[model samples]
Target: MAAATPGLIGAARAQSARKTFVFVSGAFCGGWIWRPVSDRLEQGGHKVYAPSLTGLADRSHLLTKDINLDTHIADVVNLIKWESLENVCLVAWSYAGFVGSGALESVGDRVSSVVWLDAFVPTDGQRVADLAFEGFRKAIQMAADKGEAGVHGLAKIPPIVVAERDRAFAESKVTPHPVGTYLQPIKVSGALQKVAKKTYIRLPEFPQPHFDKALADCKGDKSWTTFELPDIGHMAMLDAPDRVSELILQAA
Candidate 1:
Protein backbone atom coordinates (compact mmCIF):
# COMPACT_ATOMS: atom_id res chain seq x y z
CA MET A 1 0.00 0.00 0.00
CA ALA A 2 1.23 3.45 -0.79
CA ALA A 3 1.88 5.59 2.25
CA ALA A 4 -0.17 8.74 2.65
CA THR A 5 1.83 11.90 2.35
CA PRO A 6 2.86 12.77 5.91
CA GLY A 7 2.21 16.11 7.56
CA LEU A 8 2.02 17.60 11.01
CA ILE A 9 -0.59 15.75 13.09
CA GLY A 10 -2.03 19.00 14.43
CA ALA A 11 -1.55 22.69 13.85
CA ALA A 12 1.95 24.06 14.25
CA ARG A 13 2.89 25.69 17.51
CA ALA A 14 3.29 29.45 17.81
CA GLN A 15 6.31 30.64 15.89
CA SER A 16 9.36 31.01 18.04
CA ALA A 17 12.37 33.17 17.34
CA ARG A 18 14.09 31.81 14.26
CA LYS A 19 16.84 29.31 14.92
CA THR A 20 19.32 27.81 12.46
CA PHE A 21 19.47 24.06 11.85
CA VAL A 22 21.86 21.81 9.93
CA PHE A 23 20.41 18.32 9.52
CA VAL A 24 22.64 15.31 8.88
CA SER A 25 20.95 12.25 7.49
CA GLY A 26 21.80 8.65 8.29
CA ALA A 27 23.68 6.28 5.96
CA PHE A 28 22.30 5.56 2.48
CA CYS A 29 20.01 8.60 2.63
CA GLY A 30 20.81 12.04 1.34
CA GLY A 31 19.57 15.35 2.64
CA TRP A 32 16.45 14.37 0.75
CA ILE A 33 15.37 12.26 3.72
CA TRP A 34 15.20 15.36 5.85
CA ARG A 35 12.51 17.06 3.77
CA PRO A 36 9.54 16.37 6.03
CA VAL A 37 11.19 17.54 9.24
CA SER A 38 13.00 20.45 7.61
CA ASP A 39 9.85 21.61 5.92
CA ARG A 40 7.96 21.64 9.18
CA LEU A 41 10.77 23.50 10.87
CA GLU A 42 10.92 26.07 8.10
CA GLN A 43 7.16 26.57 8.31
CA GLY A 44 7.57 27.17 12.00
CA GLY A 45 9.91 30.09 11.34
CA HIS A 46 13.34 28.46 11.44
CA LYS A 47 16.26 28.33 9.06
CA VAL A 48 17.06 24.81 7.88
CA TYR A 49 19.86 23.33 5.79
CA ALA A 50 20.10 19.65 4.97
CA PRO A 51 23.20 18.82 2.95
CA SER A 52 23.79 15.48 1.23
CA LEU A 53 27.05 13.72 1.86
CA THR A 54 29.70 13.27 -0.84
CA GLY A 55 28.47 9.85 -2.03
CA LEU A 56 24.85 9.63 -1.04
CA ALA A 57 21.45 10.90 -2.08
CA ASP A 58 21.78 13.11 -5.18
CA ARG A 59 25.53 12.95 -4.87
CA SER A 60 25.69 9.22 -5.66
CA HIS A 61 27.46 10.13 -8.89
CA LEU A 62 30.49 10.98 -6.79
CA LEU A 63 30.57 7.56 -5.16
CA THR A 64 34.09 6.18 -4.98
CA LYS A 65 36.09 3.83 -2.75
CA ASP A 66 38.13 6.72 -1.43
CA ILE A 67 35.15 8.15 0.45
CA ASN A 68 35.29 7.50 4.21
CA LEU A 69 33.90 8.87 7.46
CA ASP A 70 36.12 11.94 7.37
CA THR A 71 35.01 12.74 3.82
CA HIS A 72 31.40 12.77 4.97
CA ILE A 73 32.21 14.94 7.99
CA ALA A 74 34.05 17.40 5.79
CA ASP A 75 30.92 17.70 3.69
CA VAL A 76 28.84 19.21 6.53
CA VAL A 77 31.72 21.17 8.06
CA ASN A 78 32.34 22.91 4.77
CA LEU A 79 28.66 23.80 4.44
CA ILE A 80 28.67 25.59 7.79
CA LYS A 81 31.94 27.36 7.05
CA TRP A 82 30.91 28.44 3.57
CA GLU A 83 27.53 29.67 4.71
CA SER A 84 28.94 31.41 7.78
CA LEU A 85 26.07 30.14 9.96
CA GLU A 86 26.30 30.90 13.64
CA ASN A 87 24.43 29.61 16.73
CA VAL A 88 23.45 26.60 14.64
CA CYS A 89 21.66 23.53 15.95
CA LEU A 90 23.32 20.45 14.43
CA VAL A 91 20.79 17.64 14.11
CA ALA A 92 21.97 14.15 13.15
CA TRP A 93 19.95 11.01 12.45
CA SER A 94 20.92 7.32 12.79
CA TYR A 95 24.45 6.65 11.50
CA ALA A 96 25.08 10.35 11.01
CA GLY A 97 26.23 10.63 14.62
CA PHE A 98 29.64 9.58 13.40
CA VAL A 99 29.63 11.99 10.52
CA GLY A 100 27.91 14.86 12.35
CA SER A 101 29.85 14.57 15.58
CA GLY A 102 33.16 14.61 13.80
CA ALA A 103 32.03 17.55 11.67
CA LEU A 104 31.42 19.58 14.81
CA GLU A 105 35.03 19.07 15.88
CA SER A 106 36.41 22.02 13.97
CA VAL A 107 33.43 24.36 14.13
CA GLY A 108 31.92 23.44 17.46
CA ASP A 109 31.84 27.04 18.46
CA ARG A 110 29.47 27.83 15.63
CA VAL A 111 27.01 25.22 16.89
CA SER A 112 24.58 26.40 19.57
CA SER A 113 23.50 22.87 20.40
CA VAL A 114 23.20 19.31 19.10
CA VAL A 115 20.26 16.94 18.81
CA TRP A 116 21.02 13.28 18.16
CA LEU A 117 17.83 11.71 16.87
CA ASP A 118 18.72 8.12 17.63
CA ALA A 119 22.12 8.71 16.03
CA PHE A 120 25.23 6.90 17.16
CA VAL A 121 27.02 9.03 19.76
CA PRO A 122 30.57 7.84 19.26
CA THR A 123 33.32 8.11 21.79
CA ASP A 124 36.61 9.35 20.44
CA GLY A 125 38.18 6.96 17.89
CA GLN A 126 35.13 4.68 17.78
CA ARG A 127 33.98 3.23 14.46
CA VAL A 128 30.18 2.87 14.02
CA ALA A 129 30.51 -0.52 12.30
CA ASP A 130 32.35 -1.99 15.25
CA LEU A 131 29.41 -1.13 17.51
CA ALA A 132 26.85 -3.14 15.54
CA PHE A 133 25.44 -6.50 16.60
CA GLU A 134 27.72 -9.37 15.52
CA GLY A 135 25.14 -10.96 13.21
CA PHE A 136 24.48 -7.65 11.53
CA ARG A 137 28.16 -7.34 10.65
CA LYS A 138 28.27 -10.80 9.06
CA ALA A 139 25.19 -10.14 6.95
CA ILE A 140 26.68 -6.94 5.52
CA GLN A 141 29.96 -8.69 4.73
CA MET A 142 28.02 -11.45 2.96
CA ALA A 143 26.19 -8.87 0.87
CA ALA A 144 29.55 -7.37 -0.05
CA ASP A 145 30.90 -10.79 -1.07
CA LYS A 146 27.96 -11.43 -3.40
CA GLY A 147 28.43 -7.99 -4.95
CA GLU A 148 24.98 -7.09 -3.72
CA ALA A 149 26.80 -4.18 -2.15
CA GLY A 150 29.32 -1.90 -3.80
CA VAL A 151 32.91 -3.01 -4.35
CA HIS A 152 34.11 -0.67 -1.65
CA GLY A 153 31.67 -2.13 0.91
CA LEU A 154 28.76 0.22 0.34
CA ALA A 155 25.67 -1.58 1.65
CA LYS A 156 22.24 -2.10 0.19
CA ILE A 157 19.31 -1.28 2.47
CA PRO A 158 18.03 -4.23 4.42
CA PRO A 159 14.41 -4.93 3.50
CA ILE A 160 13.40 -5.69 7.07
CA VAL A 161 14.00 -2.13 8.19
CA VAL A 162 11.84 -0.40 5.59
CA ALA A 163 8.18 -0.03 6.44
CA GLU A 164 5.71 -1.21 3.79
CA ARG A 165 4.32 2.27 3.42
CA ASP A 166 7.80 3.68 3.09
CA ARG A 167 9.26 0.93 0.90
CA ALA A 168 8.65 2.59 -2.47
CA PHE A 169 10.26 5.85 -1.46
CA ALA A 170 13.18 4.09 0.19
CA GLU A 171 13.95 1.97 -2.87
CA SER A 172 13.65 4.88 -5.26
CA LYS A 173 15.49 7.53 -3.30
CA VAL A 174 18.05 5.82 -1.08
CA THR A 175 21.62 5.38 -2.35
CA PRO A 176 24.47 3.09 -1.39
CA HIS A 177 26.58 4.39 1.49
CA PRO A 178 30.36 4.36 1.50
CA VAL A 179 31.57 1.28 3.36
CA GLY A 180 34.60 3.27 4.42
CA THR A 181 32.28 5.69 6.21
CA TYR A 182 31.17 2.82 8.43
CA LEU A 183 34.56 1.22 8.94
CA GLN A 184 36.62 4.35 9.30
CA PRO A 185 37.24 5.40 12.91
CA ILE A 186 35.85 8.82 13.73
CA LYS A 187 38.43 11.37 14.84
CA VAL A 188 37.01 13.44 17.70
CA SER A 189 38.69 16.76 18.46
CA GLY A 190 36.93 17.50 21.79
CA ALA A 191 35.13 20.34 20.04
CA LEU A 192 31.67 18.92 20.78
CA GLN A 193 32.02 19.86 24.46
CA LYS A 194 32.42 23.45 23.42
CA VAL A 195 28.75 23.48 22.43
CA ALA A 196 26.73 24.26 25.52
CA LYS A 197 23.62 22.15 25.08
CA LYS A 198 22.92 18.61 23.82
CA THR A 199 19.96 16.24 23.66
CA TYR A 200 19.56 12.61 22.65
CA ILE A 201 16.22 11.21 21.57
CA ARG A 202 15.61 7.52 21.96
CA LEU A 203 13.23 5.60 19.75
CA PRO A 204 12.48 2.50 21.76
CA GLU A 205 10.88 0.49 18.99
CA PHE A 206 14.14 0.37 17.03
CA PRO A 207 16.16 -0.95 19.98
CA GLN A 208 19.60 0.26 19.00
CA PRO A 209 21.96 -1.30 21.54
CA HIS A 210 24.74 1.05 20.55
CA PHE A 211 22.64 3.99 21.62
CA ASP A 212 21.79 2.42 24.98
CA LYS A 213 24.81 3.84 26.76
CA ALA A 214 24.30 7.17 25.11
CA LEU A 215 20.70 7.35 26.28
CA ALA A 216 21.78 6.61 29.80
CA ASP A 217 24.60 9.11 29.66
CA CYS A 218 22.43 11.90 28.39
CA LYS A 219 19.76 11.31 31.02
CA GLY A 220 22.28 11.62 33.81
CA ASP A 221 23.77 14.81 32.53
CA LYS A 222 22.05 17.87 34.00
CA SER A 223 22.95 19.94 30.95
CA TRP A 224 21.33 17.53 28.49
CA THR A 225 17.68 16.58 27.96
CA THR A 226 16.56 13.12 26.83
CA PHE A 227 13.27 11.99 25.32
CA GLU A 228 11.74 8.66 24.43
CA LEU A 229 9.16 7.94 21.76
CA PRO A 230 8.13 4.35 22.38
CA ASP A 231 5.76 4.13 19.42
CA ILE A 232 8.23 5.48 16.91
CA GLY A 233 10.90 3.58 15.02
CA HIS A 234 14.39 4.59 14.00
CA MET A 235 13.17 6.94 11.29
CA ALA A 236 11.08 9.07 13.60
CA MET A 237 11.41 12.14 11.44
CA LEU A 238 9.30 10.40 8.81
CA ASP A 239 6.95 8.75 11.29
CA ALA A 240 6.64 11.65 13.72
CA PRO A 241 7.96 14.83 12.21
CA ASP A 242 6.06 17.07 14.59
CA ARG A 243 7.41 15.40 17.70
CA VAL A 244 10.91 15.25 16.25
CA SER A 245 10.70 18.91 15.24
CA GLU A 246 9.49 19.82 18.71
CA LEU A 247 12.41 18.06 20.36
CA ILE A 248 14.80 19.77 17.96
CA LEU A 249 13.29 23.17 18.60
CA GLN A 250 13.48 22.56 22.32
CA ALA A 251 17.08 21.47 22.07
CA ALA A 252 17.97 24.54 20.10
Candidate 2:
Protein backbone atom coordinates (compact mmCIF):
# COMPACT_ATOMS: atom_id res chain seq x y z
CA MET A 1 0.00 0.00 0.00
CA ALA A 2 1.14 3.57 -0.64
CA ALA A 3 2.18 5.83 2.26
CA ALA A 4 -0.37 8.36 3.40
CA THR A 5 0.37 11.91 2.30
CA PRO A 6 1.33 14.52 4.90
CA GLY A 7 -2.12 16.14 4.66
CA LEU A 8 -3.89 12.84 5.13
CA ILE A 9 -1.52 11.92 7.95
CA GLY A 10 -2.41 15.22 9.58
CA ALA A 11 -6.09 14.49 9.39
CA ALA A 12 -5.64 11.11 11.02
CA ARG A 13 -3.30 12.46 13.69
CA ALA A 14 -5.75 15.15 14.69
CA GLN A 15 -8.17 12.53 15.84
CA SER A 16 -5.65 10.41 17.71
CA ALA A 17 -5.90 9.94 21.47
CA ARG A 18 -2.86 11.24 23.33
CA LYS A 19 -0.27 8.67 24.34
CA THR A 20 3.19 8.34 25.91
CA PHE A 21 6.31 8.18 23.71
CA VAL A 22 9.93 7.13 24.14
CA PHE A 23 12.44 7.86 21.36
CA VAL A 24 15.92 6.36 21.08
CA SER A 25 18.50 8.03 18.89
CA GLY A 26 20.75 6.52 16.24
CA ALA A 27 24.49 5.91 16.56
CA PHE A 28 26.72 8.86 17.43
CA CYS A 29 23.68 10.90 18.45
CA GLY A 30 21.92 11.71 21.73
CA GLY A 31 18.25 11.91 22.62
CA TRP A 32 18.42 15.61 21.83
CA ILE A 33 18.10 14.62 18.21
CA TRP A 34 14.44 13.85 18.83
CA ARG A 35 13.63 17.28 20.24
CA PRO A 36 12.06 18.57 17.05
CA VAL A 37 9.69 15.68 16.63
CA SER A 38 9.02 15.36 20.35
CA ASP A 39 8.15 19.02 20.62
CA ARG A 40 5.56 18.64 17.91
CA LEU A 41 4.14 15.54 19.48
CA GLU A 42 3.93 17.19 22.89
CA GLN A 43 2.14 20.17 21.44
CA GLY A 44 -0.54 17.76 20.34
CA GLY A 45 -1.00 16.65 23.99
CA HIS A 46 1.28 13.61 24.07
CA LYS A 47 3.94 12.82 26.66
CA VAL A 48 7.42 12.34 25.21
CA TYR A 49 10.70 11.15 26.63
CA ALA A 50 13.87 11.09 24.51
CA PRO A 51 16.56 9.46 26.58
CA SER A 52 20.26 9.67 25.71
CA LEU A 53 21.98 6.31 25.73
CA THR A 54 24.71 5.44 28.25
CA GLY A 55 27.86 6.26 26.21
CA LEU A 56 26.70 8.92 23.77
CA ALA A 57 25.39 12.48 23.77
CA ASP A 58 25.47 14.18 27.14
CA ARG A 59 26.40 10.85 28.69
CA SER A 60 29.71 10.55 26.76
CA HIS A 61 31.68 10.93 29.96
CA LEU A 62 30.77 7.29 30.67
CA LEU A 63 32.10 5.92 27.36
CA THR A 64 33.93 2.64 27.66
CA LYS A 65 34.65 -0.59 25.80
CA ASP A 66 32.30 -2.21 28.27
CA ILE A 67 29.26 -0.21 27.19
CA ASN A 68 27.66 -2.90 25.07
CA LEU A 69 24.17 -3.26 23.58
CA ASP A 70 22.77 -4.45 26.88
CA THR A 71 23.86 -1.24 28.55
CA HIS A 72 22.03 0.86 26.00
CA ILE A 73 18.97 -1.32 26.41
CA ALA A 74 19.05 -0.84 30.14
CA ASP A 75 19.16 2.89 29.68
CA VAL A 76 15.72 3.04 28.07
CA VAL A 77 14.19 0.12 29.91
CA ASN A 78 15.08 1.69 33.21
CA LEU A 79 13.53 4.98 32.16
CA ILE A 80 10.17 3.39 31.47
CA LYS A 81 10.37 1.43 34.68
CA TRP A 82 11.40 4.41 36.78
CA GLU A 83 8.78 6.72 35.33
CA SER A 84 6.15 3.98 35.42
CA LEU A 85 5.36 4.77 31.80
CA GLU A 86 2.79 2.53 30.18
CA ASN A 87 0.94 2.04 26.93
CA VAL A 88 3.99 3.57 25.26
CA CYS A 89 5.01 4.24 21.69
CA LEU A 90 8.67 3.26 21.56
CA VAL A 91 10.58 4.78 18.66
CA ALA A 92 14.08 3.68 17.72
CA TRP A 93 16.25 5.26 15.06
CA SER A 94 19.16 3.55 13.26
CA TYR A 95 21.36 1.40 15.52
CA ALA A 96 19.09 1.79 18.52
CA GLY A 97 16.61 -0.47 16.77
CA PHE A 98 18.96 -3.24 17.86
CA VAL A 99 19.29 -1.74 21.32
CA GLY A 100 15.61 -0.91 21.58
CA SER A 101 14.49 -4.38 20.55
CA GLY A 102 16.63 -5.95 23.22
CA ALA A 103 15.23 -3.54 25.80
CA LEU A 104 11.69 -4.53 24.90
CA GLU A 105 12.29 -8.04 26.12
CA SER A 106 11.86 -6.75 29.65
CA VAL A 107 9.05 -4.26 29.08
CA GLY A 108 7.24 -5.25 25.93
CA ASP A 109 4.06 -5.79 27.89
CA ARG A 110 4.17 -2.16 28.95
CA VAL A 111 4.46 -0.97 25.39
CA SER A 112 1.48 -0.39 23.15
CA SER A 113 3.54 -0.25 19.97
CA VAL A 114 7.04 -0.09 18.46
CA VAL A 115 8.33 2.08 15.63
CA TRP A 116 11.52 1.52 13.69
CA LEU A 117 12.47 4.82 12.10
CA ASP A 118 15.11 4.12 9.50
CA ALA A 119 16.51 1.57 11.96
CA PHE A 120 17.82 -1.95 11.85
CA VAL A 121 15.55 -4.65 13.31
CA PRO A 122 17.81 -7.47 14.33
CA THR A 123 16.58 -10.94 15.04
CA ASP A 124 17.46 -12.63 18.33
CA GLY A 125 21.23 -12.89 18.81
CA GLN A 126 21.87 -10.53 15.85
CA ARG A 127 24.15 -7.55 16.36
CA VAL A 128 23.93 -4.16 14.70
CA ALA A 129 27.35 -4.67 13.11
CA ASP A 130 26.21 -8.01 11.72
CA LEU A 131 23.28 -6.44 9.91
CA ALA A 132 25.49 -3.78 8.32
CA PHE A 133 27.46 -4.19 5.08
CA GLU A 134 30.88 -5.79 5.53
CA GLY A 135 32.77 -2.64 4.67
CA PHE A 136 30.82 -0.52 7.12
CA ARG A 137 31.10 -3.19 9.79
CA LYS A 138 34.84 -3.32 9.27
CA ALA A 139 35.09 0.44 9.59
CA ILE A 140 33.37 0.39 13.01
CA GLN A 141 35.35 -2.60 14.20
CA MET A 142 38.61 -0.94 13.21
CA ALA A 143 37.68 2.05 15.31
CA ALA A 144 36.86 -0.09 18.35
CA ASP A 145 40.15 -1.98 18.00
CA LYS A 146 41.91 1.35 18.30
CA GLY A 147 40.50 2.02 21.83
CA GLU A 148 38.28 4.95 20.74
CA ALA A 149 37.29 5.02 17.05
CA GLY A 150 36.81 8.04 14.76
CA VAL A 151 37.34 11.03 17.02
CA HIS A 152 38.63 9.14 20.02
CA GLY A 153 36.56 6.20 18.66
CA LEU A 154 33.58 8.44 18.02
CA ALA A 155 32.17 8.14 14.50
CA LYS A 156 31.77 11.61 13.14
CA ILE A 157 28.67 12.25 11.08
CA PRO A 158 29.67 12.88 7.48
CA PRO A 159 28.96 16.50 6.66
CA ILE A 160 27.53 15.72 3.24
CA VAL A 161 24.90 13.34 4.56
CA VAL A 162 22.99 16.26 6.02
CA ALA A 163 21.52 19.29 4.29
CA GLU A 164 23.84 22.29 3.85
CA ARG A 165 22.06 24.41 6.44
CA ASP A 166 22.25 21.81 9.24
CA ARG A 167 25.63 20.27 8.37
CA ALA A 168 27.58 22.55 10.65
CA PHE A 169 25.19 22.05 13.55
CA ALA A 170 25.07 18.31 13.12
CA GLU A 171 28.86 18.15 12.93
CA SER A 172 29.13 19.89 16.27
CA LYS A 173 26.63 17.66 18.05
CA VAL A 174 27.40 14.12 16.81
CA THR A 175 29.71 12.05 19.03
CA PRO A 176 31.44 8.71 18.60
CA HIS A 177 29.19 5.73 19.37
CA PRO A 178 30.67 2.93 21.49
CA VAL A 179 32.24 0.17 19.41
CA GLY A 180 30.99 -2.35 21.96
CA THR A 181 27.41 -1.40 21.24
CA TYR A 182 27.77 -2.36 17.61
CA LEU A 183 29.87 -5.47 18.21
CA GLN A 184 27.69 -6.99 20.93
CA PRO A 185 25.02 -9.40 19.71
CA ILE A 186 21.56 -7.91 20.17
CA LYS A 187 19.33 -10.31 22.09
CA VAL A 188 15.56 -10.31 21.68
CA SER A 189 12.89 -12.38 23.36
CA GLY A 190 10.42 -11.85 20.51
CA ALA A 191 8.57 -9.57 22.91
CA LEU A 192 8.61 -6.62 20.54
CA GLN A 193 6.67 -8.53 17.91
CA LYS A 194 3.94 -9.16 20.45
CA VAL A 195 3.16 -5.47 20.80
CA ALA A 196 -0.38 -4.66 19.81
CA LYS A 197 0.85 -2.63 16.84
CA LYS A 198 4.12 -1.88 15.02
CA THR A 199 5.22 0.47 12.24
CA TYR A 200 8.33 1.01 10.16
CA ILE A 201 9.13 4.37 8.63
CA ARG A 202 11.66 4.35 5.79
CA LEU A 203 13.73 7.34 4.75
CA PRO A 204 14.88 6.25 1.28
CA GLU A 205 15.97 9.72 0.23
CA PHE A 206 19.16 9.23 2.19
CA PRO A 207 20.35 5.66 2.51
CA GLN A 208 22.05 3.94 5.43
CA PRO A 209 24.14 0.76 5.66
CA HIS A 210 21.56 -1.70 7.03
CA PHE A 211 18.14 -0.07 6.75
CA ASP A 212 17.21 -1.25 3.25
CA LYS A 213 17.04 -4.85 4.42
CA ALA A 214 14.94 -3.77 7.39
CA LEU A 215 12.67 -1.73 5.13
CA ALA A 216 12.24 -4.75 2.87
CA ASP A 217 11.34 -6.93 5.86
CA CYS A 218 8.76 -4.46 7.12
CA LYS A 219 7.26 -4.02 3.65
CA GLY A 220 6.80 -7.75 3.18
CA ASP A 221 5.40 -8.42 6.64
CA LYS A 222 1.61 -8.38 6.70
CA SER A 223 1.63 -7.28 10.35
CA TRP A 224 3.46 -3.99 9.97
CA THR A 225 2.27 -0.62 8.72
CA THR A 226 5.02 0.86 6.54
CA PHE A 227 5.50 4.37 5.22
CA GLU A 228 8.04 6.01 2.93
CA LEU A 229 9.28 9.58 3.21
CA PRO A 230 10.78 10.51 -0.13
CA ASP A 231 13.65 13.02 -0.25
CA ILE A 232 14.03 12.87 3.53
CA GLY A 233 17.22 11.66 5.12
CA HIS A 234 17.59 9.14 7.91
CA MET A 235 17.32 12.06 10.33
CA ALA A 236 13.77 12.77 9.31
CA MET A 237 12.85 13.93 12.83
CA LEU A 238 15.22 16.82 12.25
CA ASP A 239 14.67 17.44 8.53
CA ALA A 240 10.96 16.70 8.40
CA PRO A 241 9.55 16.96 11.92
CA ASP A 242 5.96 17.74 11.06
CA ARG A 243 5.68 14.90 8.60
CA VAL A 244 7.45 12.46 10.90
CA SER A 245 5.23 13.41 13.81
CA GLU A 246 2.14 12.83 11.69
CA LEU A 247 3.26 9.38 10.57
CA ILE A 248 4.06 8.48 14.16
CA LEU A 249 0.69 9.76 15.27
CA GLN A 250 -0.94 7.87 12.45
CA ALA A 251 0.62 4.71 13.75
CA ALA A 252 -0.11 5.56 17.37
Highest TM-score: give the candidate number.
2
TM-score of each: 0.85, 0.87
Runs with alpha carbons beyond 4 Å of true place in candidate 1: 1-16, 139-163
Per residue, candidate 1 scores C-alpha lDDT tens digits across 85-134 of 99899999888988888988888889989998887888888887688777
Give me the candidate number with maximum lDDT: 2
| lDDT tens readout by residue for model 2, 132-215 | 666777888778777763323224444325555666677788887788887777777788778889999888876664677777
